[model samples]
Target: MATDRRDRTPTADPPATDDEHAAHLERSRRVWDRWSDWYGTSESDFEPIREAAIDRLDLQRGDRVLEIGCGPGVNFERVRRDIGAEGELVAVDYSPGMLENARARIEAHGWENVRVLRADATTVEFDDPFDVALATLSLSVMPDIRRAAETVYRSLVPGGRIAVVDIRSFPSGPARVLNPLVRRFLRWYANWNPDGGVVDALATVFDECEVVDTHMAGTSYTVVCEKRDAG
Candidate 1:
């Protein structure tokens, strides 16, 4: 097995200040904007696994759900179906190109309940507390996972749930050899940090957190967390 990079290397941390983070966000937005067409929102083979991640939320009718980094709104319909007409869906993404696609999807479906907002996940001011949230393959790309996690936790109602499906470093077995390639590909493709603390940050902020499971050939892990009831 390969040695743990955590033990031998100290990679630079993400932007710590709001300005730096904003710049980082702009860079990501530009990247996505330029490539949004190539990275279309069409369905894929991983749809089932992604749906499984949403399933972890156990959405109910009339629930208010938030989707962070909701690229192109591919999951919008799936979520709206669960939430029904009474429920509201707020999907946020920084990329204007992506938001355009999302808005198109919403209009095409005539999903009056689904709303798209163009804002950064870490700083977006949510007008209301959400009942459930889902972040699919999006948290790892965030400039600051801890800040993003804090924002998500703060936006949820007491006892509200969140399901995050993200990539994690393949730590064991023969797959360890593929870590370097995987890391490079993900970084180039989306600036994703597979070694990031998305789960750890959420676990620290949420009262109850669990790794629901790993999917996509063990390349992704789904974490479910619940905000504690108000004291």
Candidate 2:
């Protein structure tokens, strides 16, 4: 299996300071911008898993779909296609390069129903709730994982569905014995990851949640949450 390079980077001191957050976003944009053209192409190596994540949306025509941290709009097109002419698809991400790449693809695909925007997942507003929402592999990088999950929970309709998948942090038996040293190193290189607290946090918002799938190595997991109907 391919290891996520992002996980190996030490979380910066103080986790994510204001200045550090700004620099993090800037660095992300620069890094993505450099890979814009090949952003969603097969050479990217994430295309297959990306498609799988989109498939979890189970979109229907006329449905309202929102994608948070939509990198290069890889899965946006898939959702748009599923929505057909009557539905709406909105994609958001903080990285300018990601938005640019996503916009280009939306145009190339002639998907007028799809809209891409540059916005922070931690705090973004939508005109109305959506029928389905997806935050594939993106929420894991958020600086405020809890607030972001709340935002996502709030963005859904009364009985909407949310699919989230990402790499979470866990301690290895040997690594645990190593003490704070390992955690100290991780705290410096990584940002607020969704894969860690989402399972528990989501339980508070959604009526019921289930871990739908997981990588054999336990490095990543996918979960589905449903918003139950009102009383």
Candidate 3:
């Protein structure tokens, strides 16, 4: 079962007011801005986990996809390859520094189909519905995971697919011993709270949700779901 393990050291309770949420958002943006340059380099080891998430996306040559919190565009190459020249990839990040890296990556590769925008995933608007939506290691950091998931769900067309890969609290037993160290590492590096209720949030928005434990003794999970037709 999933547990709520949000970091209590930083704030004992979740934000209760708009001002508090705004403050947390600003702090998170600043953290990512400072870490943008080293973000990709630091996460090199987790490339496979990201690849696994993208694989489940099952992108096709002409599919339009939306990627939330696409820091440094780490998934760009694989997404580009799968989506091909005909498809469109819309990537959003709240951090300008992160978007800068993503833009640079796109320019360097001459990928015309990929567009990077600086916007908060919870409130960003899409002109067209997407065929697929993906969020890798990002949902846990959102100011409101449920809002973000709902936004993603609304941005997708009926029958559209969504995938989310994120970290959660470690399971009990020997793995429980490593929680403190792992939590500290995540807090210092990504400002993530593993108790964000990501899976629960997704379940509320998507018609069907499937979760797979991806790594670190059930500390990470991959969720795939499909939007059902309104009819």
Best candidate, lDDT:
3
- The lDDT, on a scale of 0 to 1, for candidate 2 is 0.69
lDDT of each: 0.80, 0.69, 0.82
Candidate 2 lDDT at 119 equals 80
TM-score of each: 0.88, 0.75, 0.88
Mark the regions of model 1 whose C-alpha exceeds 4 Å error after superposition.
Answer: 1-15
Question: Residue 179 in model 3: shift from native, Å?
Answer: 3.1
lDDT of 2 by residue, 61-81 (tens): 999998888877767666777
Name the lDDT of candidate 1.
0.80
RMSD of each: 5.2, 7.4, 5.2
Model 3 sits at a Cα RMSD from the real structure of 5.2
- Give the per-residue lDDT of model 3 (tens digit) for 1-231: 232213122222253367756866787788899999998676777778888888987899999999999998998999999999999999999898999999999999999999999887888898888999989889888877877887888899998988888887686667787888888887777777555678777776677777854677787778888788652
lDDT per residue (tens digit) for residues 159-179 in model 1: 898888888768578988988
Clashing pairs in 3: 5-195
Model 1 poorest ten-residue lDDT run: 1-10
lDDT of 3: 0.82
